[model samples]
Target: MTCSPDDFRAAMRRFPSGVAIVAAGSAPHRAGMTATAICSLSADPPQVLACLNRLSSTCRAVEDARFFSINLLATSQLALARIFAGLEGGVSADQKFTAGVWRLGVTGAPILEDAVLTFECALVTAHPASTHNIVIGEVRHITGEVAEDALIYRSGVFGRWTGLAVTQPHLS
Candidate 1:
């Protein structure tokens, strides 16, 4: 049960996760970040949870905005994800938004129009998790593109989901 950080990374590499960008636009300091630490938190009211680093520029955007949107990237969107994730400081946050195409979600967060699936939500709750904040959001609107394959993250790199049948029968 007790694993070092290296062990934690190794364990996580086994569970491939869908790649997404969480974005908000309450200020000129719009927030967007590549994320794989996303999960469903509720069903009845439709909620989602995303874990965020406290010092990330994306965190500041969420802290100031009432709502945010999740952009599920397709394989082609990998470049976009990297751009947002690569921005290293406060001065570059706004410029990152300019690199992608977006539309205002119900709460004004920018939803990447080319995303395979998108979610807009109202902030509902947050809890501290050691070094990251687990923020929950109540879903307000969602859109999807069934034909596009999803992007995935595993083994410290980005890849696209093939959507092939699981003939291997392995849990992962």
Candidate 2:
């Protein structure tokens, strides 16, 4: 028998993940969503992947624009993340963007100016998965350097990374 949605969600909640905002489009058509399903896919050509729900407006915008941005959030930006995630006091989609300073990237997608790391990417391909689509983008441009601390989500709670207590002994 297949696992129920509640079972799957509870299991997934045990995994810690970084928070990000996936943005696409411009002006009146822009769309974004808070996501924790983003990850690096390759380093050779610089690629990244962001998984989005198939029925989300953000997903539709990304598919239509053929471009999108993955803006990694800083620990201080939890409120902004909540806005984008549609959880901040019921703010509407169009108004959610007002919470942050946004700038157009090379791909014409909105990039959060204060993001710890931002990747401007061109759509590569998308693979359908159950209730979501794995959207792959080739990193065409990037903004900001990695930050010391990042916003993390786990077990329905958000936290900040304070760096590792023990440093790595070796370097690549």
Candidate 3:
């Protein structure tokens, strides 16, 4: 039995994930894309993994620059996420940076100043996997404070994650 692409996507959408913008390159030659397929790969060496579409300009930029920044979004950054995702009308690739306050990281990758968290990384490796590349990086710098609310995506909708209260169960 084989699962269809649409079915696989639908199934995956059931799992909510944090939103992020993976950006590379410098101004006037930069590229970025909204992504949810980023996660911590290791802690001891401080590494992260981000999946980029093989055909995306961002992926090519990462390949050429050998550096990238993962800007984890806060709830207030929904507009920025939409812009990077190409969901905002009249905003072209060259104009995306205008929507957010950005700065150059140590690696020269563009970082969102107001992101919930920003990880500037040096590209370690990128492995081709089907339609995407599994890009790994060693974190070189980090910034931003812990936000009270974070942007999340689920079922094709953008949302926020607030602190959830957990109650301890009573035991005899």
Candidate 4:
């Protein structure tokens, strides 16, 4: 038997992904949102893909900002992650970053200073992907923790650092 739509979604959610809040903006119009669907689409050209809802405010910001940043949240950044995730509803794009610890990337997108990693990128391509659009970005700048662990989402909750264990054998 084929999996129902809900079953497919449930199964997909079981696979944990590194949490990241992708930011894009131009000063007062900046916007960001938490995303767990970003992934490497190509290694040769240093490209990655992010999926964002077409109607999301952040999605609109990305369209006009010319650049985007992926801030890989550390395990300790759960609060920041939640804030950007829109779990508490939307806030003015500028206001959202006011309380968070962030610094500007080369592309001018806000990069969380405490993030495990951050990638500043320029849009390369975009295509329709189900209810969202798959944005492919060309990595332009890279910074942040080379050794820090990443926060993860699993079973609709966050509290894991799988990257820490995988990267540091000493911790394993």
Candidate 5:
């Protein structure tokens, strides 16, 4: 038997994931949405994958622009995240930029000036997967250093990764 949607969501909630805002386009026409479905797809070619809902305006912008930036949020950016997520009702597409400092990336996508990390990428391909588009992008630019105070989402709650134990295991 297949798991129900609610069951699937419940299971996925147990997996903690980093929070980020995926943005595209230039000023006056930019689009952005809070996302947790971004990850590095490859290192050699420097690629990343971000899943966007097929119906989101940002998804269309990314498709039309063929470029986007993934801005990883810090714990301090919870309000920004909520704004992009449309949780701050009545905030229009253009108004969301007013909430954060933004700059144009090499790919022309809007980058968060104070993001924990930002990845500017050129669209490689987008595959339609059920209700979302699996967007693949080739890294064109990167900014920010790795920091411990990154934002995370799990179990329907937004939180931060507390520095537990930093360790590197040797592979023999």
Candidate 6:
């Protein structure tokens, strides 16, 4: 039997994911959206993948410009994430940058200055599946800080890394 959308979504939500923003284009035509489907693909050529909804303006911009940036959010940036996700009504397409400091990357995509990590990539390819496009890109530039904590999402709730870890016992 085919899985129902609600069931699929519920199951997927159990897996905690780091929050990020996929942004494209420059001022006046810039578009961005909160995303969680980003991951490293390869290190040889420094590649990564970010999935964007096909109908999102950011996705269309990336397609046309052939580039994009994945800005990984820190735990303190939940408000920014919400704003970029369009959850905050009345914020227009171009005004999203007003919520945070942004700069143009080497590929001309908007990059969040305060992101825990930023990956500026040149679009390599995109594969369409259902309502989203799996956009693959080759990393051209990156900047990050290791001390920053990350924002996480799971089961419709937002959380953060508390920097807690258990010490491992010695093993032979």
In every candidate, how many clashes are there?
Answer: 0, 0, 0, 0, 0, 0
Worst 10 residues of 3 by lDDT: 161-170
Q: Identify the runs in model 3 with alpha carbons over 4 angstroms from their true place.
A: 169-172
User: What digit string (tens of lDDT, one per residue) describes model 6 on residues 59-89?
Assistant: 9989988889999999889999999988999
Give the candidate number with the greatest lDDT. 5
> Which residue pairs show collisions in model 5?
none
Q: Candidate 1 lDDT (Cα, whole model)?
A: 0.83
What TM-score would candidate 2 get against the native?
A: 0.92
Ranking by lDDT: 5, 3, 6, 2, 4, 1
Model 1 clashing residue pairs (backbone): none
lDDT for each candidate structure: 0.83, 0.90, 0.92, 0.84, 0.93, 0.90
What lDDT is obtained when candidate 2 is compared to the true structure? 0.90
Q: How close is candidate 5 to the true structure, as a TM-score?
A: 0.94
Candidate 3 structure quality by residue, lDDT tens digits, 33-146? 999999999998999999999999999999999999999999888989999999988876657888888889888999998898999999999999999999999999999896
As a whole number from 0 to 100, the lDDT of residue 37 in candidate 6 is 90
Per-residue lDDT of model 2, residues 137-164, tens digit only: 9999988875657899999999986667
Which is superior by TM-score, 2 or 4?
Answer: 2
lDDT (10s digit) by residue, model 1, range 1-172: 6779988879989799999999987546687888999999889999999998978777767767878998889887777878877744543676777766887877788888888999898888768888888889999999886567788988878887665675766676
The digit string of per-residue lDDT tens for model 5 on 104-124 reads 887789999999999999999
Those runs of model 2 whose alpha carbons end farther than 4 Å from true positions after fitting are 146-148
Model 4, 1-172: lDDT tens per residue? 8889999889988898999998998667788999999999888899999999988888888878879999888887888888887666765567789757777787888787777888999988778877898988999988885465788898898977543334554553
TM-score of 6: 0.93
**Superior candidate under TM-score, 4 versus 5:** 5
